[model samples]
Target: MFSIFKTFFWLGWISFGGPAAHIGYFRHTFVDKLGWLDDQEYAQLVALSQFLPGPGSSQVGFAIGYQRQGLLGAILAFIGFTLPSVLIMLCLALLSHKFNQSPLFEGVVHGLKLLAVVVVADATWGMYKSFCKQKLTSGLCLLTAAALLLIPSISTQIILLLFAALIGCKYLASNQSNTHQRFTPSIWPLITFGLLIFALPLMTSGLPLIKLFSDFFQAGSLVFGGGHVVLPLLQNIVGEQISQDAFLTGYAAAQAVPGPMFTFATYIGYQLIPQAPIAGALVATLGVFLPGFLLLLGVLKHWQHLAHVPKVSGALNGVNAAVVGLLLSALYQPVFTSAVLNPSDLVFVLVGFYLLKQLQLPIISIVISFILLGVASNWIV
Candidate 1:
């Protein structure tokens, strides 16, 4: 438990970029370094998180801890990985001035965004090698990437994944024994998940705390994409309750912070209940994140068992390949286009990539280098 908390705690401080980048960081640290799980297990976990409605990276992190140390590890993982961003968002809420547009903030954020590109590129390439070997799978990967790059949305992603699964069922299934034992998974998490969605709304009329929790829980339960997708849902949830500018500021701050972007809930919670800011932050953060973990718990073990059946395994393979394509489209649109603006930015990414992939510099060293260069360039300008 201590190891789980401590590692994710330190990771919470340095994990910038967002969900795609976090995937890369996790693959590097856990799979490559610690040997926690192999590439196949990691790929399945990523695919599962994408299918689920919540923070993609946080679910993956929680799944990792669960694989390592079960339920307690999952809880510790979520808390440790999420706590730093939650605190940062809370601090931003308490502060009178939002530094989102400040020059220093821009410099730091730019650096992190650049780092995201390098990390995501590495993850995409590495996973491609693992998941997209055969011609059909490779075609699935490239086609999925093309379609998403052309038309991107949560719906688009899900549909493509389903389409890929169909293809996998047809063409990718391996011949094996059909006999398999029945496996029953604990359904309490799924039941609790349904109950909260139904009960929270009914209980929220006169109570601000309940209202706060209900709003976030709904957003967390419904939002299907990554952290960026949650912002609009949260905006609707906070309508007229907080000023538009303040809400926008929290969005910007969430991007600037170093953990799960979902911690934007913490800021909104603090703003919603200034009288009991910390409690608000805790409740809001937990509310937004709890559903995701619960859903993970409910399906994860069953998903693991299903992976062994021949046809089901093929479908997961297709899903895994699609996952890489998702990473590819993400690496370009949000991670690349957002960060690499000019020649200098392009040059920096190339060098950063080379350092990370070819020379194999420690990720932290690369992070510090990016930060230093970004700040220096900002100062020079």
Candidate 2:
């Protein structure tokens, strides 16, 4: 457990460029170097994370830990992988007064924002090749992207996923099923998941922490896309409590941080309850992450069998394609639109994208380069 904690804690401090990059780093560290999980095993976990909601990469890390040393290992993994970013976000909340107007700090955020665009673009292409390989799957990806780009609402996303599932079941599902291990998944976790979905609302008024949990938990349960998708949901909920500037600041800081982007909640929580920020951070972080872990625990044992079932597998294929589309759309609106404001910013984005996809520079180097460029441009101007 200590080894697991130490390993992920180091990752937490330096695993930047968001969830996709973190996934890559995990693969290199655990799969390649440590030999903890084989490529297939790691891929399965990544697929599971993508299919479910809250903080996809974090859930993958948790699942890996669970496989290694059970529930306690999973808990330690979450802590190890999130603690650095959580601490950073909390500190940002505490010192917002000092840093809010710092131009250099603003430049770092700006650089990170552009880096986000590049990262998402790279992820979109990689997922496209991996998940959208088949003709029908690729078409589904395009259709989902178009629909989301045009409609641009949470309802549209949900409706498209449902429709895609139906289409997948009807067309892509095969009659022949593959053989896999026979293991029954426990029902208790499923029950707990449903219970919380229902019970959190009813209990929200009882305690402030309960309300906080309810909000973050609900966001976790609903978010299908990943880290960036959490932004809108969180913005709506936390926007009620903090200034728009503060909320945006947290989101930007989250992009630069080395761990789970969901730690953005840590910043929000601290800001919301400055008097007891640690408690606030704990509840909010746990609430947002709880649903995904519960879902994983409930389903992991049965995943092999489920993956072989034609109808279910077909639907998952559709979901995977849709995931690509969701990432594509997110790459544009909030990410590209919010950043890449001027021609100079555009130059940075193009260069960053080239460096990421073509030159294949390390993300840390790219981040550093952008930060320097941002500061230089700001100062020179």
lDDT (C-alpha, whole model) for all candidates: 0.88, 0.79
* Residue 364 displacement in candidate 1 (angstroms): 1.6
Candidate 2 matches the true fold with a TM-score of: 0.76
Scored by lDDT, the top model is 1
User: Could you say which candidate leads in TM-score?
Assistant: 1
Please give the lDDT score for candidate 1. 0.88
Clashing pairs in 2: none
Model 1: ten consecutive residues of lowest lDDT: 177-186
lDDT of 2 by residue, 1-381 (tens): 799999899888767667756775677568756999875466557667866777888999998889889889998998999999898888877777577457887676677667767766766776677777788888888898899889987678777777777787777776775665565786998899999999869977757888888899999898776788888888888866889888888887787667898998888877777668789988898888889889988987677787777786677667767767776776777668877789999999889888876787875688789888878877776
TM-score of each: 0.97, 0.76
Query: What ranges in model 1 sit over 4 Å off?
Result: 176-179
lDDT of 1 by residue, 1-381 (tens): 799999899889888888988999899889887899999999999988988999999999999999999899998998899989987887788774756667887888888788889988989999999999999899989988999999998889999999998899788887876558555667999899999999779988788888889889999998788888888888888889889988888888888889899898998888888789898888898889888888889889777667777888889889899999999998998889988887888889999999998899987899999998787777777
